[model samples]
Target: MKQLPPEYYALLEELQAVDFVLVELTLYLDTHPHDYDAIQQYNQFAQQRGLLKKQIESKFGPLQQYGNSYSGYPWNWDDAPWPWQV
Candidate 1:
């Protein structure tokens, strides 16, 4: 198996954590649409998710096919299985 830097793993975990929180908040907001606090929390977590995705891509590489995989640059979908492959 390939080994990645510890920080990459940490960032991945943080991203997952943020996603989970966002999911929970979404569910809560669905049932309580008027709860402004939950809506704010959900929006914050969504932004965090986007930022984490950008950070991971900037630090490591693209995590999917849509991220510069075919933008006349080198193909990177198969570059780092250590961080994405299970």
Candidate 2:
């Protein structure tokens, strides 16, 4: 595989970790609905993920083709490298 820039990998790794935490918290909340602390943690991570996604989109481009993440001129999504390719 081609090597991506270190910052790209770092941002992706952090996003993945935040997403994992959010998923696990969701599962936990499904069983323990009254756990306010866990709910707060989940919300915090969700916010972090959103901010990180925005940063990623700004620096790299849309993470998806059909969503609001698209920006810039000439609709370059088709020309940018895919995540797995880098």
lDDT of 2 at 49: 91
Tell me, by TM-score, which candidate is best: 2
Task: Give the best candidate by lDDT.
Answer: 2
Q: Residues 48-70, candidate 2, lDDT per residue (tens digit)?
A: 99999899878877776666577
* Local lDDT at 29 for model 2: 99
lDDT of 2: 0.82
Q: Candidate 1's C-alpha lDDT? A: 0.77
lDDT of each: 0.77, 0.82
Q: Pairs clashing in candidate 2? A: none
**Cα-based lDDT at residue 46, candidate 1:** 91
Worst 10 residues of 1 by lDDT: 64-73
- Tens-digit lDDT track of model 1 for 1-86: 55678888899999889989988998898899999988888889899988888888877777657443232247556564645474
Q: What is the C-alpha RMSD of each candidate to the true structure, in Å?
A: 2.7, 2.2
**Residue 40 displacement (Å), model 2:** 0.3
TM-score quality measure for candidate 1: 0.81
